[model samples]
Target: MSEQSVRRPTQKSRLARYLIPIGSMAAALSLIAIIYLGYDLAKGRISPCEAVFQESSIGLKTKISFLKTEGELEIGREQLAELTERAQMTALNLKTCCTVLDAGRVDPEQFLQCKGSARSYEARLDDIAALVRTAVKEGMSTGSVATTAATAAPTPPAHVEEQIAQEVEAAKAVSRDFNKQVVQVRKEQALETLQATPPQNVTIGAQEREPNSDLLTTNGLSLDTWVTAAIGDGKDSDYFVFTTPKTYRDRIRVELQNRSTTLEPRLRLYDASKASLGDRYNTTTGADLSYDFVAAPDTTYIVRASNYYGESAGVYLLRVTPTKAYDAYEPNDDILTAKPIELGSDLAAGIMDGHDQDHYRVETGDAEAQLLVTLTNSSTSLRPQIRLFDASKASLGEQHNTTGGGDSSYLFKAAPNTAYYIQVRDYYGDAAGTYTLTVNEAQPGG
Candidate 1:
């Protein structure tokens, strides 16, 4: 047959051979281009902001994982749970930031917000790390999980908006030192301005015209005098100052009564240096609170009256007066100042002051097998507890009874001729009343 008639490969088959190889090559090249794009993204070969977002996302994931491991090592299960939760929240916050960045070019305000949020997360992470360290230390020392954790370090202050208005005139009468006297003057002026134009629907009594909102410039309170004032919105507090000389007014009583049924009254005491003095007294709305404290020599004291709820506005009556109330013998609240008691001695005393604890020392005979100590609280509401310590102040026995009565009794044998110390304290730290104590010897097993 001739060549053409013999069917030398058809044109279609000839073309298919070359086209198939070229098509395969083209497909392989396209796959390689796609892979290169993926590689570029994975390597962060992107704009600066996009790279930042990518890095942050990865970093947050790494932190979450790290926190999980650290949490496992923590001794406190609560701490571990808190850390895990915070890590998860941080991961979610990072995602939110990434979404914002992905939308488009980052707006200035939006970027700042993201940055602030990131900083907050970082601060929390630091705090958690510190807490774990502290917990580990405390556990090693006490052989138990710590019930309290130290507070975190302060964070950097945020940027505040700048004032655009022209600056006001400088003060002419004030000295540059800005002492307390100057501060009081400024406060007085502010008070006058506030009183002259009281808030709508609010009234300031003629007797309570001055605003004694600060500890330094508290309104003066004379003994046995009663005064009334109204609390205003948002941190409005009234402070009253009184003198308690060691000789004349050493024992003083302070009373507060809330007149408004909707307002809860709270009171706090401060010393001349503005340091807090005792437990904060608070009562239900319209209830009264009375506090007695033996003041230091020639000292100035402050009484702070305010609404317990921040938003509540109401009126309260306050009185500071000298009372015939018994004072806890001064300098006897600690082991160093313990009142000495002999065998078969009966002593009458009072807790008198809020938070007061009475300490006594007793001498035991070598022949004596045991000592019987009894306490009777005068007030049924006052629950007193007795703690007995050896001469070294190491606690040996304790008796605290509430079901039977507010009284406590303990019988224990001490080391031969041992000097023992007894302590009396209120169970809840707020009870104030008188108590009678007695101690006697008894035979063992009797």
Candidate 2:
């Protein structure tokens, strides 16, 4: 008995004697408390750190996955979705690494041993995954990290194959295949903009002129005045009567009966000595043609035109004029003491108040024959005027203007006794034609 006596409790090891029982009992209670307290913890749901850790884990796995499938056909979009989802799952695990620490559930010192194991194998060394792996490896338990990872896994991103395909198609529409289609489209648009954007619209400051040519030999003394051909090449030795006062102020505008035609014209100037003034013209173009030279007082110029040059033949008008003009005269002639003039009917010369037109009859050379019209002084706003001419449409002078008087006389010494037609027009002017026109032959001074 003495011997058997207590070999008695040969001093049991610490846990076998008292600590084990106490620990086992306490563990059950601890489990319940841990679950409840974990539920109550401020950080039980997620430590944003887990996101970083999850990203790192899945990131390494994804990178490894991509490497494993290298040189394969483009990854089917479906497979890519699966891989991304896995990455998001792993990313969630990292969320708990720090929160467990914050909640005192993890002793950072004890977790340090597992730090390396927790690291995510990301090819990129960004601190995110590296940090989570470090925190987990520091002895962070697998259960702690894994639970958070599972919960934090991002929901699979919505499959967007249709949307992606549409976006791709839209991008390719402008560049089908390998060609850059925008180049041509852009170039064409630029060209159209340039052409349609309207020109600078210069108001013709200094006129253009052509100074020298070896064609015409005549000092423009007079026109050939040929009935031989109303619309043909002009006389080789004839002249024109257009002049330019200063080289800087000369321009000759030309228009063929149609733009499809061309012409070569010559102009020569002469002094009182009948000597050539050393100026001339000769050209061929479908548009306005001009001659330039400093003009002298007693000099005369000319325009000898021909349907010459590379173009079609059409009726064209060639005008001859001096750049500087003479003062204008009013319309005047007395039909007062005279005859029964029918109004509205065509007259030898008078204002046709109805159509707002004017009439003029010219004698051969009397540029002085004119209509003397007197109008009331009024606002100079709309100074509409009308003048009439012969078959050539030479300006006989304004047959109707709002400035002249009621007893206005329209006299024409230009055509002493020729039957002329007058259509007075242009009535919108602020001034009214108060006085009616009186027609009488202008007293002529030979």
Candidate 3:
């Protein structure tokens, strides 16, 4: 081979050597860039607000984990668990918001929604952090264990435990207040958006009638109809009356939309006797109000709307809708209205609200017989109970299911032609749902 040829081959070898390392370095740099970009995306690079919220959430979770590890802490396990669950939920919501924001194609409404969610998460995380800090501080102060030569676990002092409980309750109350504020913020934002563009396909049935400030001169409102109204001045209030359908009991939902920027709406409900059932109002300016109740059949209910501060005056929209229909045996919530149930017949009914009670009357023929009253709970949250009363409203006996959504039966001897009243309700009086009640005569000598 000639010297020129050998020299050309050596030069080519050097060039190949240089290109190999250069290619490898470029590849390595590309990999590093990819890893960095993945991390940046994951950390919410598109939304600095979301990034800050996420960091705060992570810090809160860390504090909660630290609290959970303190086995000797006097904090209630349930409270800690609740705090953890709430923290997890906050984190999940933040993550969702971040994802939406990072998508880069979100519309204005979606962006606003995500921003609102982030704000809510931030507030909730702060509340949770405060709660955790309280628990940690209380635990540190009261969690001292007595030790001897041999290891021993000692109970906290009674006073210390009581103090911790009180502090925990107070912290929980603070958290609840924060949660309410968050909800109010979301509601206000929603109302602003909704008022900007009213929902489609909603029928405006009637307008407010004047001289309707009091219940006596109230305007008549049809069920499931929207009414447009306005508060002329601070003291002005609109009263609308509607009677529940006589066919069946129903769950009535009342919604008030504040159409003006200056108005804070307040809503109140009254029964036929002018007794207040409940009231809902917007604490935030320009926010809407909503309330729901189980209305008995053929009952007249009055709705009153006014400015929340009684100062701001503006136009508003009101609508009353019946959301759910209950069983035919409704309006039998007391001894005076107990529905009659025949032997071997099963009737379905519902406990529409926490305070609702259903009463049924059973009469036996002209013979002494053993009566079996069975109540089967249909909702997972309902622990059904049956109470027996004589015709004179004297209590005879009661039976209730220990487990939720279980069955209960009461057996008693019924004299001929005697009337017994059966009252059904949730055992705890804090749950609502449906159940089936059966009245049957026991077989003789079986």
Which number leads on TM-score? 3
The sequence of per-residue lDDT tens digits that candidate 1 reaches over residues 1-446 is: 78886566676688999999999999999998997678567766565555555555555556546556653454235544554454445444444444444432434454455555555555555544555445445445554233334443222112100110000001111111122332443455467666766432112333454557775446777667778887876488888777765543246789877777756677888887779987454647666778777765467777888777666677778888777454445457678888888778778887765567788999877664678889987776667788999988999878886632378889887667789999987777776667889988765467
- Model 3 clash count equals 0
Model 3 gets an lDDT of: 0.74
The TM-score values for the models, in the order shown, are 0.39, 0.19, 0.44
Q: What's the C-alpha lDDT at position 139 in model 2?
A: 26
Q: Please give, for residues 1-446, the per-residue lDDT of candidate 2 as tens digits.
A: 68656665565564387888788899999998896576446344655455446445645565636533431122245544543443444333233433434422435552342233234213222222233233333323434565576764222112332333343243233122112222333354457656765422111111211221222332221211211111333422323333343322222332222233444434344543446654333455444444443333343444444444423333433433444321111122211112233323223322223222333332333443543333222233324454544444445565444444322234444453344444343455323232234343334451
lDDT of each: 0.63, 0.37, 0.74
lDDT of 3 by residue, 167-206 (tens): 5565555445444544554566556655665322222257
lDDT of 1 at 94: 43
| Runs in model 3 lying further than 4 Å from the true structure | 1-205, 211-223, 232-236, 241-250, 258-263, 270-277, 283-288, 295-302, 309-314, 321-324, 363-369, 390-394, 401-406, 415-419, 427-431, 441-446
* Displacement of the residue 217 alpha carbon in candidate 1, Å: 3.1
Residue 219 Cα positional deviation in candidate 1, in Å, after optimal superposition: 4.5
Residue 165 Cα positional deviation in candidate 3, in Å, after optimal superposition: 50
Better of 1 and 2 by lDDT: 1
